[model samples]
Target: MVSTRVDELNSERHRFALGIFMAVVVAHWAEHLAQAVQIYVLGIPRPAAGGVLGSVLPWLVHSEALHYGYALVMLIGLVALRPGFVGRARTWWTAALVIQVWHHFEHLLLLGQVVAGANLAGRPVPTSVLQLAVPRVELHLFYNAVVFAPMVVAMILHRKPSADERALTRCQCARPVLV
Candidate 1:
């Protein structure tokens, strides 16, 4: 029963779901890029450097709830869409999934710190282990790029698979394999 439902999710009719997930991911990426520009190019302080949506809802950028929610969404999206890929694409997708899992863990760690009122490594605000080396804004940008890149590659490969890949694919994501 569950397998049937999962197969449905990976079907061509449900491509819209994948589209929506990618849209959300792209929007989040834009926000991070905008924030980076505000900081490095505009000389704005991190606290004041609200991105597009952040300008309207200034608290959004600093909200642990928002950060953690997005991380959770990304993780869920990756896992749910994974079965659609095959061969090389499946490998790339798995890579992205692994990275996203780590990214989710980092967010969870940060959320835990925020809840506990103690930052990692004695920082004033909640911080991830990597945040000790890179600022939160920058670290998140790096994470998003790494995760996004592989997912994009996977999507491209999924759409146009080789013979072996087409044979391996369970979903109709790629062109139909010829005899």
Candidate 2:
């Protein structure tokens, strides 16, 4: 009785999870395609386009196939990692995405400072735990706030119920046979 309802809820969460993943994947891919066309085909220099919008676009674009491929694989693989995690899906996913964004920011900040031409210092900062590139720092904050935060918050706040929406929502054992 309860188990059947749970199964239905789990299925619903799975569908929602898949939808979220697909949306992100498509958006990422679209960004990449746009960048490839803009940078390679259109021949726009990264520096010449220096601005908020300019930097935002490149973060989504990856010239390397393996880079995008790894993200796609991870996104797909997360589905089967746990059979019963469907209910708290939004909570876990929101947390996971926050971690992902933080990791990404670390890399972005590092690359911006260390990579050639990315440095706003006009020269590299040496022996510095905090390089403090104002432009890059501002952009980083903006990106996290505008792009990552809203998405994560929306998912968390509007999470639809799933089988395990709560541990006590329904028991996890097999459903009893219907007469």
Candidate 3:
């Protein structure tokens, strides 16, 4: 009884949840891309070249609360939706999840530094270890790319699973078998 309900939820309902999560992820990606273009292509200064939402809420770019909140959201979404994947999709998803865990930890560290009024490695601003070598904006872009790439691959594999993968799947998100 409970197993059937779980299967149903992982089918249609899981897909819906994944769709919403992907939308949010894409929006965040757009913001980062916009910020990058503004800085590199448009030659706009970082403080003035607010991204899409940043133009309206400029403070959001520098807000620890916003950064930490989004990191938490991504972490939660990855973990919650993970069970629906199987085989190769599960492998790719696990890779993304691991990277996101690290990414979330970095954000947590930055947020903590901001709240404590201290910067890491004696820098002027709160910084992740990677940010020590790469600029914050660029580092974040790289981080997002790595995380997003594996996740996208996982989603593709999930939608079109191999026979073995289909067998291993616990959800109905994969393409239906033809009679």
**Top candidate, metric TM-score:** 1
Q: Which stretches of candidate 1 lie over 4 Å from their true place?
A: 175-179
130-164: candidate 1 lDDT, tens digit per residue: 98899888899999999999999988898899977
Please write out the lDDT profile of model 3 over residues 1-179, one tens digit for every residue. 96765556566688878889999999999999999999999999977876889989889998987999999999988987887888899899999999999999999999999999999989988899889989888998998999999999999999999998988777667878788
> TM-score for each prediction?
0.92, 0.31, 0.92
Local lDDT at 158 for model 3: 95
lDDT leaderboard ranking: 3, 1, 2
In model 2, the Cα lDDT at residue 33 comes to 48
User: What TM-score does candidate 2 reach?
Assistant: 0.31
lDDT tens per residue, model 2, 8-119: 5445554455456547644554544454455556787744432333467553322223343543454333433234343454556555555555435445444445444454
lDDT of each: 0.88, 0.43, 0.89
Model 2: residue 55 alpha-carbon error in angstroms: 7.6
Q: What are the root-mean-square deviations of the candidates from the true structure over C-alphas? A: 2.0, 13.2, 2.4
Measured on C-alpha atoms, candidate 3 has an lDDT of: 0.89
